[model samples]
Structure formats: C-alpha cells, structure tokens
Target: MSDPHKKIARKAELSKISSSFRRLSSRATLGAMVAGAAVLMFIAIGVGEHLATLALRENERLIGNDLAASVDKVLDGASTSSRANVKTLPGSPCIEVERKLAELETHLRYVRTVALVENGRVYCSSALGPIDVPLSAYVQARRRAKDITLLAETPFQPGVPVLAVFSSTTSNSGVLYIIEGEYLSDVLVHGVRYGAERAAFAISGNGVLDEKGRFHTAIDADAPYSTGVTSRAWPFTILVASSPSLMTRQRWAFAVASGAIGLLVAGLIAAMYLLAFAPRRLLLAAVRQGLKRKEFHVVYQPIVAVSDRSVVGVEALLRWHHAKWGPISPAIFMEEVESSDMLEEVTRFVLQTALAEMSALTPAFPLRIAVNIAPRDLQRKGFVAEVVAAVRSLPPNTTLVLELTERFLLSESALTSAAFSALRAEGVRFAIDDFGTQYNNLDLLGRFPFDYLKIDRKFVSQVDTVGADLIAGIVALARPFGVKVIAEGVETQSQHDGLESVGVPYAQGYLYQRPATAQSLATSISSSAASAQH
Candidate 1:
C-alpha cells in the first residue's frame, strides 16, 4: 500500500512539470507571431508614406514645368502677332492693331483680355466686358521695366478674376495683358480633377485665387506658402492628396491585426523575462506620478523703445519645465495644451503671473505688459469678462497691451471686434502684431481703434537697408491716424535711426536688451534710464 501511494505522488509531480513546459512553449510561439505582424505593419506604413510623397513631388515638378513652358509659348505667339501688325496695316495702325488683336483674341479664347501698353500707358484692351484697372505701384514698376511680368489670377475688376502678363516688345516698349476669364473656371475644374489624387493649387501674390473653379480651398494668393518665393509673384503650388476614407480603412485594418499580434508576442516575451525582470509596474507608476506633478512657469521678454532704448513693455512668454522631458518649447507644449482643452488654465496662469509680477514693480516706472491672446481664448464664453477682471486685478498704472496676430484677429471679425472693444474699454492698448505680413485690409486698422501699430519684423528688418519706399508709405499711413508706429526687430543703429528719422517713435529688438525676469528687468530699466539721462 505504501509503494502504491509513493507511485501516485511521483506521477502527479511529472504531470505538473509537463503542463508548465507546454504553457511556456505556447507563450513563446505567440510572442514570435505578434512581433512578425508588427514588423510587417511597420513596413507597409513606411512604403505607403514614401510612395505618396514621391508621387506628389513628381506631379508638382511636372505641372510647374508645363505651366512655365506654356507661358513662354503664349508670349512668343503674342510677340509675333505684334510685329506682324506693325509691318502690314492700313489707316491708323492703332485701329488696325485693335482689329488684329480682336482676331487673335477670338483664336485664343482662353486669353481673356489683351492690352497694348506703350509709353507707360495702356493704349488698347479687349475683354468679355469692360474692367476697371486699379493704379498700383506694381503696375507702375512693370511699365518702367518693360519686362514681361506674369501675374496669375489678379482681380483687376471686382468679382472678376484675370491673369495679367506684361511682356516687353522692344527697348522701353511693351504690351500689358489680362487673360483666362471664363477659361479660368474651365482650367480649375480640369486641373483639380486631374490632380484629385493629390492636393494641389496655384496662387498669385495679390490674394487672387487661380485654383480653377474650386474656390473653397483657394487661399489668398498673397498669403505665405510654407516654401517658395518670398516676394510677390504668382507661384503655382501643386498638392497631391490621398483619399481619407482609404487611409482610414487601411489604418484600422492594420492596427487591429498588428495590435492583436503585438499583444500576444509581448505577453509571451514578458512572461519569459518575468523571472529575470520584475513586472514593469514601476514605469506605469512613474508615468501616473508625472501626470500629477506637471507644472508651468513664465518668462518675460522686454519690448524696449527704439529711440531712447527705454524699456517700455515686456511680453510674457510661457515655459514648461517637465520633470522627465526637462524643458518643452511653448510651440510643442501649447499644441498639447490646446488639444487637451486646458488652454484656458494655461492662459489664466500666464496672465495671473505676469500681472502679479508687473503689479509688484515700481508705480513710477509705468511699464506695459503685452500678453499673447490665442484665438481660442477670444471665442471662449466669458472670455472678454475674464480679461476685464484680470485687468481690474492689476495695478491701475499697469497698461495691458493686447497683441493680436493677423491670423488670429481676422478669423472671426464680429467676435474679435467685440472682444477688442471690450478690452479697449478697460484701457487695454491694442496692437496688431505682425503687421504687413498678410493681406490685411488697411481699412480694418482705421475701423478698429487700435492705439499702436507694431510693424512686423519682416518689414522692420528691411526698412533701413532696401524697402525705403514701402517703409515710408507705412509710416505716412499710420502717423495721421493718431496711431503710434512701433517698429519691432530694430537690430541695428541704422534701423533705429531710419525709423526715428521717419518719426517712428517706438521700437524693440535684441539690440536694446534680451528678455529677463521681473527682478532683472527693474535693474536693467534703471541703468538704461540713467544712461539716457546722462
């Protein structure tokens, strides 16, 4: 009986060991399968993205080359016709030239209107209807140069789009043109259909939409593209867009298959390593702890006066010093904050900190604090009231400079205007930050009772060196309207002198002083003011 009991115990032990080995083998196999799936999915995504990018880039190159070649052909044809009209014509050549031009127009129906420019004046024109031409510096420049200037989709007439191509015929003589009126619609329809597989469009420098017939995606031609020419000219942008539905379906299918395989593989690998490595409970714990411990801090950059180099204002810049990530840039963190819907909290913290710092400063100093207001903040319910309350909390002498960027300000005209008025009522000075960088309505400046016009850094950077006429015109426009011009990015003494020479009373840049903490700013200002007095 004792021998039989011992035999049963031995059998049970062997069975237990066998079961454990089987479990281990199954986990290992599962892990391998998951890893293989993950690798395959990764490869597919990489290949798809590469293919899409290559196709789009190649299409853009091809289209640009074709358009340029076509333009050259058109110019050559026009030039030949002009010479022929001069050689053989009865009576007034102008009348005969007009008749020849009419015949040419009928042949090239796509060419909207042809204008014969001679002696810096448009002598003759033909179109579907009469169009009024606005006198502009660009037109004057073209006339003076006697060189062919192609302006794609310029709105010479209100509610009408036309392509203007100016070409020189001989020395100091030329023909100015307008083309693709009704044909523009046809071209857009055709182009968009052809390029439907990829996102693409073309634009001119004067806020003209030349995207064939699809006016929906047509941005202001004057608006900045991510790349290409910085100066005003019609630059054609071709975009190749992927089908969203197809992408979504592919992603979903891949994710499901890959995720299941990855989980199985990871589980098997984790189990095998469990004996050597403790479960990664600490990593998850650390992440949870980090989320709770996250905090934000503020830094200040001074916006000083160009003339006396006096510290007039400070822009409050936000910084996040994450424990794990160290320091995250405002651009990256702000994106996260916005996506998380915690922007109001961030904005409150920044405003409160800046106002508190400024309030602690000496009353006699009278420094303005410029706070960046995001577009989302402007649209928030009770946002205007919150701003009013925040301003009230600050010292009476502390002036709040609401710096509204062009992109943010003009998005919702009625909402922005109301917000602007509300803030202005609280003695908050409004400044259009990055002025002249976009196709902004100058009339909007007149409409909005803004106290200061902060000329964009781009314009300021060039004012002293190259763009004198433009700078002069901007200063002239601002002066009479009681709007004080504050030139930003005044890096050189020459820039400062040029701005001061033109009566631009205020400025700010690295030349004056870098941004500092409130404590450092006080010391800097005292020293600056003393130097000015001396």
Candidate 2:
C-alpha cells in the first residue's frame, strides 16, 4: 500500500474512535441521571411506608383509649346513681332507684338503660320494669369485681345488641348501664381519610363481640394488621382492624413526591454534566475565579439629549477579561451564567458596581443610570429588595432605570409584576430595551409601566422618509402614555436630525461617543461640565 493511502486510512479510523467516545460520554451522563432519579424515588417510597405504619398504629391506640374512657365514664355515672339511692336498695321504696335510673338514661345519649342488680336479679330498672332473669357467670364475676367491667349480650327486650358496664357498690350490690353496641363501631370506623375500611370489637372475658355486639369477630379473624388495646379500668379490650388501603394511599403520596423530586434531581444532574464538559467547564471555572478575584468590570455609554447633543445619562455594560479567554463579551458569559443558575450573582455584581460608579460620578445633572435586568432575576422574590439596597447609597437626585429586553419583558409573571410595582413605588423607572424588534411592542407598552421606549438599531438604519415616519409614529404614540422614545444606532447627521425632528428626546449610539470605561466617561462628563462653566 502507498504511504498516503495508509495515512488516510489511519485518519478515518481515528475519526470513528472519536465519534464512539463522544457517544459513550453522552450515554454515561444520561445513565447517571436516570440512576439518581430511581434512587430518589425508592427512598421516598420506603420513608413513606415507614411513616404510614406508625400513623396506623398510633390511630388504633387512640381509638382504643377513647373506648376505654367512654366505658369508665358510664360506670362512674351508674355507681354514683346507685350510691345516692342506697335507701331504696333491694327493699323499702324502689321509687328512688327508678327515678335515678330514669334520669341517667335521659342524660346519657349512649346509655340504653340503667338498672340496679342484687343477688343475681334485676330489682329496679330505667326501661325494663322489675326483672327476674338469671345473671350469667360473666355478669356475676363483674358484680364481684371492685373496678368497672364491660360485657356484651342481648338486651332484655330481646334480639337487640347491647354493651353493659357494671360498677359494684359498697353494699355488696352493683349498678348496670347498658349502651348500644354500635357506639363502638362509630368510634372505630368514622372520619379517617387514609384508611379504607375499619371495624371495632369488644373483648369480654374469652369472647369477642362484633360491631353489633354479636359473639363473633368484628372483622375477619385473619385480617391483616389486626391491633388491640386493653382497657385500664375495665376487663374489656378494644381491637381495631384495618385494610391495606391506608398504606396504599401513603404510597401514592410518596409516588407523587418522588416524581417531583426525581425530576428536580435529574435536572440538577444534567446541569452538572453540562458544566463539567469541555469549554463550559473551563468557562465556569474562569467565571468563579473572576468573580472571586474581582475580574469582571463594567463600561458606560453616554445616553445623549437628542436636541442639544449633551450627555444626560449612561447605560452600564458588563465586561470580563479572563487570563485565558481574554476580553469575553457579556453576551457570551451572561448567557452561560444564566443557564447555569449563576445569573443572580452576576446581576448583583453588575448592579452593585454600576450604582457605586454612578454614585461616585456625581454628574452635574441627575443622570439616569440604566441597568439591564434578566427575566429570571426579575421573577425572584428578593429582586426588588436587592435593587432597593443597591440604590440606597446613590445620590438622591440621581435616577435608576431598569432596562429589560423585549423577550424578558414579555415573560413577566405575577411575581415579576408585583416586583416591578414595588420598585416603581420606590421611584425607580423601567425601559423597554430594543423595542421595535418584537411584534408585541404595543402589548408590552400597555402591560408594563415603561418610562422609555428605545428603538432598535435596525429601524434607525433605514435612514429614509419611511424611517422618519415610523420613528415619529412611535414617539407620537408613546407621548400620551407618558413614555419617552429614544433612538439607537444613530451614526450619521441625517439619523440625528431625523430623530430630533420627530421630537425623540434621547439617543445612544457611536455618533455621539462609543461605550467607554467608567473613568473615561467620568472624564468626559467633567470635561463637558468645565467647558459649560467657561
């Protein structure tokens, strides 16, 4: 093979290898982002499940505690009623016992009836008049106990489920208060948002009473996550049965949170990747060092009075002279930082430097120093506060104007609008930068409170009769709305005369003077002021 052919074939092989490396690099970055998102989602689900379990257990214990307290209350009421009417106990006048029992039944909503039991027989009752039914072994045991006891049974009226609380008196007798068993059901199964279904049961002796006081389980015996709590004062225990729906809902919540977190994490990882590769990495590093070492600087271009051609104010422009990149344009670095979330810092730097420089200038007139603001910075909650702080040290007579490009102005949200309103209240003015370039100029003029409309260079470059008419129309349209018009890129005598004839108040371009450093601009202002004094 010839030597040239061999060299050409080797070059083709190197190109393929480079392309393969690029593809691998991109895939590796994408895979890392996907893995980070997956890990975040799994962590969210695990944390949520653990929390849901805790909440379910806590809720069950609370319900059980409430049921126990309710039983204690009923028992106390019955005991009080029985002791107050001991004179009518098993003999003598039973009228006092009947009257007390009737009063208790009327006052307690859950209470079915109140009765006085002695020697295994009901002597007097609130609803059931004198009964001789045999007391079961469960009731007898409760009658002998010193504390309150709960039992479930069929009511004396037959076929109705009832839960009875027994409190033994000092006279070897006991007081009984019967309540509807569904009271326990209502406490167990009502008003919980997470749990799908719930059931409650009362354990009396060795048997479990269902929601309706039947001798059976309130839920299936093999129900998942069965929890129970024993009463402090009574022999009864309350058991709560819960389904899986509570956990399901919690998982759903976690899923939603995880999705949002995953997206945020993925976006952050992608941004990191972008910052780590090639020229961007070097650029970001340079920016960080530049900011740290105070390498970023600003220049001022004089905005002139069109009729007199005198310098009225200056527009601040950002510049960065890197040791490596050397004299980097703000259009490049600013866009880089904006995409990388460092725009706020850069904006703050520009604002602080511009305000300080303008303050030091102390021009003869109240110069309106205009600072460009990005849309993202304007939307931030603290943007207005930052601007206010930056301008606080300036000369009271000097005016601060915020200049926004048409794209940024159109992207204003409610928060940005509110910020603008606040800044306006503090006497800060706003201007629409590069106005005749976008189609929605009129809409923007109406929506935002703009003090100045600067025509773009393209429109002023026409330099003909039609250009004069367009500039005049804009100035005329803006007059009634209290907005002053300025022309940009006026390089020739014809453009200057055209703008002045149309009554345009201000102009900024190379025709007057190109943008200069702060020291040079200050010199020109001083030179002009000294000349005026002569």
TM-score for each prediction? 0.43, 0.47
After superposing candidate 2 on the true structure, give the runs of residues whose Cα lies further than 4 Å from its correct spot.
1-20, 23-282, 362-365, 464-466, 527-534
Q: What is the C-alpha lDDT of each candidate?
A: 0.60, 0.70
- The prediction achieving the highest TM-score against the true structure is 2
Q: List, residue by residue over 108-180, the lDDT tens digit for candidate 2.
A: 6677777776766657778876665444522545444544323445545555555666655535456666766
Q: What value of lDDT does candidate 1 attain over all alpha carbons?
A: 0.60
The regions of model 1 sitting more than 4 angstroms off are 1-295, 335-340, 362-364, 411-414, 527-534
Per-residue error (Å), model 1, residue 381: 1.6
Please report the TM-score between candidate 2 and the true structure.
0.47
